[model samples]
Target chain A: MNNHDRFVTDTAADIAAIARTEGWLVPPAPIGRIALRPWQQAVFWGLRIYIGIMLVIMGLGFFHVAGG
Target chain B: MSAETDILAPAEADRITYTEELEARLHDRLRIQRLRSAPRGLANRLALGLALIGPGLLVMLGDNDAGGVITYAQTGATYGFSLFIPLMIPLGFIAYLVQEMTIRLGAVTRRGHAEMIWKRYGAFWGAFSLIDLVVANILTLMTEFIGIRVASAIFHIPYLVTIPLAFAFIVGILVFLKYYTWERISLFVAAFNLVFVPLALFSHPDWGAIGRTFTGSGWALPGGLFSAGFLILVSANIGTTIAPWQLFFQQSCVVDKGLLPRDIAASRRDLMLGVIGMVAVAISIIVISGQYLHDLPNAASLGDHSVLAGIGSRLGHGAMVIFALGLLEAGMIASIVITASTAWAIGEALDVPRSVNISPRRSLYFYAPAILGTAIAAGVLMLPHVPVGFLNLTVQVIATVFMPAAMLFLLMLLNDRELLGEHVNSPIRNVLSVGVMVMLIVCNGLYGIATVFPHAL
Candidate 1:
């Protein structure tokens, strides 16, 4: 085999070994899901709310700039 | 649905991954092996280190984008060698600490940040981060083009001419060159970011006053600390320093460069150098603007073209030409790196053949989005009276709105013990990281409020 093909085959083996141990590069399913704790959930939701509000405020301001 | 087919699926999947990784990273892997076998010496180690210095350096230099240069210029002109110059030192360390996590994650996990988020967090949060990244990238790319468009004015080039040429050059390098060559070309381009250094020296800044900023006198705010203008410049500086595109770009770059766990220390050293380069250039621009442009009419609100014009009149036409080149280089280099960040992230999330190495003929779809995104940004900039300046404002707003969440994701991934094993963030690291994160989020909030409600501040 050519060096490049050999490299691919060798890498395939190495990846398979790693997949068994670490995880796949493009995992079909997540290895595990992070179930957020209460505070963490709150923080995430707060950030979401913050993004929503800022987008609205900025959106209005944007129109003002465009219109102005 | 047969059992045999199911059984073969994983092996096939592994092979596909192997093909992609090898295609993208074969050169890097070979270099690592050669470095391993080569005789150990100071000169050899330096060679090896240079070989290993792609992701961190690119990301840090990449952070000092067109928008970043303008922000630093604004800081210097408005605040004038005050707190902001000294502020850059800690900001540099913060950038280092934040980016260092990505190196560890990339080296150990061998997966890009986008892939990691998609896999561990599932598609809901995955899509959220991806949309944010892509949207932010498109909008930010607009500002880069605008910078290039305007900065080209210094050379008597019209925006009509500069924008198309800039667009073609950015697209050509990204689409035509593979990862290794692409990075080298990019670094060569990025080195021009330091042109600000000479421009600063030419300005003949007061050495004692500049030194005094670090010696506790720098805290004297020329503009009141609570002024809306001061707050805006500070937020811009902070936003430009630590950014979302940075996390995706550096991590994917490391994975693409095929860095193993053994390369982590060298990568950290690489990241440190990037931070230093990023900050020093930032300060240089600040010094240049502080010396020449600060006293110009309404200096704080001056655009890049205006800053260059100011420099020309004050420092001479020759220095202005150099400064303009620096500005154009900032936009050009940023356009390249940020576009790659988008392509890499989208390629990872979609599970397509994504890499700098992926031949356009084989997997053209992988390259289309970034190129298309760039085209859209450039197209928008070219349209008649398109309110392109407002779009730059939108870029800052989107970036501010997105940064806190980006930091949160980085910290969570670093603390993922199952993935990182013993390399997980230590307790002290966690505390410091959380502190910085909280501070960033607060600044982001203030950035939002100050931007949206000019009267409120």
Candidate 2:
């Protein structure tokens, strides 16, 4: 088998072993997709606003220097 | 059916599916295997502890990069150890708090900070953060190269030789070595940073006076504390200790090291040790510079290269050589880390293969950005009469603009219960994180104003 295929098989076995040891009924798998909750989206927007204000301040500083 | 048969046999035997959870479990297995085989004794515990200590120690030493060393030296020469020595204590705490969150996040989530941000915050913020981190990292890498040039020149080594040598050394390790080997080599380079501590002893600084400065009026500024120059130095020191790249670097490093939740206490001990070493080396530089160069004319104006030469003249040539070696190692070690961080962040953001364990052929996209950054920085330094001072100022400005944004993301991530579960920020942690975030914002604002309106400061 190729290296990538072998890596996958080995990783699957390893995860299975760990899940069994920890008494997890179902073994965890790789995250195929990520969808944030509503609260997370709100926090994300808050960050965007913070970054936007910072950019504006930076622009003003640029203009102040230019006008001088 | 056996667990392995149930999980692995039914999975497509011909193809390997690589996922974040699977990768984390594989690391868990590796740690478990090591523990099973190691003999039970004090020696075994020591070995295990040594094995677990890389990410935190590397991050702290990486903070004392070439630019950071120069800043400390300038602090000592201009103001002496009175103000900044005491200042290092608080800075160390800040460093620990900021970095410890990364450890918990990495262990609990099993994802790098970049991947976590992307998964939770969506593409706009993820892309924005990636761009900011990459730009800052490349610019910072240039300063490291400039540092390499200055230290090499002290020994009369040409730029043509030093730049390429640095590139080869940095790229060779990443491309060929696995994570464990790469980390150990990097740690050895980091230990050289303590060369300053012994050199401090060589300077024969007045211990009684140094002690008095700690308790007596040393906290008071020689000139007014709010002077433009003092504020600029303070900003630089803050910029050096806490940085945008450090958050990305440490979180990714812990993930790469495969640390699990059970390893958290050992990791904290590792982090505290690193902080102590970092502060010791920083204060040592300040003390040595204060003793020998404090009274010299133009001491404040002299760059790090000249300062080293001046200190060498007074203390003897051997001291200068050791200083140059330390500077070289600082630049080299930080270049390895910064470049790797850039690579890891880009790889995770793009959903590409991103571990050091993958073959070069499979992980080309993962490794390319880092190699490209190192190459570009090395090329820039080889140009004739490069404006080193302007590059330094640009690094500080980029850091001032980017650090608060980085800290905000870290604080938000720490509070996310979905990501951290029981490991989410506690009340005290929340207060400390917010307090640090506010302090960084205020400091960066002052630095921003000073940069724009130099005369106003």
Most accurate candidate by DockQ: 1
All predictions: root-mean-square deviation over Cα?
6.1, 5.2
State the lDDT of candidate 2 residue by residue for B352-372, as single tens digits. 878765657777899898899
Question: Would you give me the overall lDDT of model 1?
Answer: 0.78
lDDT of 2 at B240: 77
Worst lDDT 10-window in candidate 1 chain B: B1-10
lDDT score for residue B74 of model 2:
73
Clashing pairs for model 1 are none
Fnat of candidate 1, please? 0.30
Give the poorly placed runs of model 2, Cα more than 4 Å off.
Answer: A1-68, B1-33, B36-39, B297-301, B389-394, B450-457
lDDT of 1 at B429: 80
lDDT of 1 by residue, B29-105 (tens): 65555565588988888878888888888898988888888778777887787888989999898898889999999
Q: Kindly report the docking quality category of candidate 2.
A: incorrect
Per-residue error (Å), model 2, residue B81: 2.2
**Reproduced native contacts, each prediction:** 0.30, 0.12
